[model samples]
Target: MNSIWVITKRELSSFFDSLTAYILLTVFLGLSGFFTWLYGSDIFFIGQATLQPFFSIAMWTLFFFIPALTMRMLAEEKRSGTIELLLTKSVNDWQVILGKFSACLALIAIALLLTLPYYITLSFIGPVDHGAVWTGYFGMLLMSMAYISIGLFASSITNNQIVAFLLALFVSVFFLIIFDVLAGNFTGSMGQFFNFLSISTHYESISRGVIDSKDLIYFLSISFFGLMLAETSLSKRNIVE
Candidate 1:
């Protein structure tokens, strides 16, 4: 088998083999659904078709869920020492990193798609801007991928899944919320840096139908930096051993 596909198959199988995958999907969707109905009042409050509430809620949900899902990616393998077995195989570091990344990316894509009924419901009940809805969803996916990549790197660093989860959660929370919050505390160009550094700011901006190339690059760059860091960790495992 090709190295990339081999690693991908391994990751996909692990996700499905565990009940947590189903649990995550159910919890994420169910929680988001409940919040949507509760907050949006099922669109009664807005009285128009808008997914702002949905994305607003989902941003919070993904913050926690991504860590939970990604905590075990490499951390558990290191815990069991099976990472050595995989390293002995034909796969290169990129293949391993990309494969693990692709599997989580696929999972996020599936979970995002499952929320389509909400969009359909909005479209049915009122005049909804489907373009904006789709754009928001796309922005959410891109942002989620970046978050997941951070979690993946965290997982790669340790043999303890809890540590990985906390590390990933901290990083995500910083980028997702703290950076934006700091914008208020900083001044001028420095504050602008925080706003630019704020994943939430960029994500919400793009989610609101203003998709900029810079925003896309921000998302992609974080994702790349994370994967590269994971590979770097894997490379250093020998020294630590």
Candidate 2:
């Protein structure tokens, strides 16, 4: 517990010490805000008194940014041989994974926090669907968690941050795009199964303000599977060296 918090704090401090956190936050907030207000399918274009545009943009923003954020979790540590030192501490493999995962989530949370003004502005302008807004944020957070876990797993399997980033993005693409495309191409039960596998489907479902147990299960299953793979990778490395 305490060990996990220590690692979390360490990772957070490291993020701020470098320019990673600031850059990611700025890019995330900027892109999201821009698309939500100015350029793309913005609120003015939608004219629905909903935060759906922001939510849609956020989902895409996280697809790229979360991978970049998690690319260094273990990949950089292993590259610099700090992972060996890290393993020698009182912390266990899961704690390290959880710590890193929590740090990434915290950073995403901060970025999300910065977008609160979007909601506030929407409320001031017109009638806003509070339920949808809440669920939209929840959906994005869950989607981000799944991506973060996948990114951490990708980071664990490689020693290069670039490789980790690409691998994470590759794996995430299946859930984000490929599966959805494949799902549409298929028919009957097969199409239904593929649609079930797509993260976008579940995200869209939850973003509409309906929280289903199946959606929760879907996100949790991916997150848990990714974290388990990461823990396995770390444990193997620890055993080898």
By lDDT, the best candidate is 2
Residue 156, candidate 2: how far off, in angstroms?
0.3
Model 1 scores worst on lDDT over the 10 consecutive residues at: 39-48
Count of steric clashes across candidates, in order: 0, 0
> Model 1: clashing residue pairs?
none
Candidate 1: tens digits of C-alpha lDDT, residues 172-232: 8889889999998999999999999999888888888888998999999999899899999
| Regions of model 2 farther than 4 Å from truth | 238-241
Using all chains and alpha carbons, the TM-scores for the candidates as numbered come to 0.95, 0.98
Judged by TM-score, which candidate is best?
Answer: 2
Candidate 2 on 45-78: residue-level lDDT in tens? 9788889888888888999999999999999999
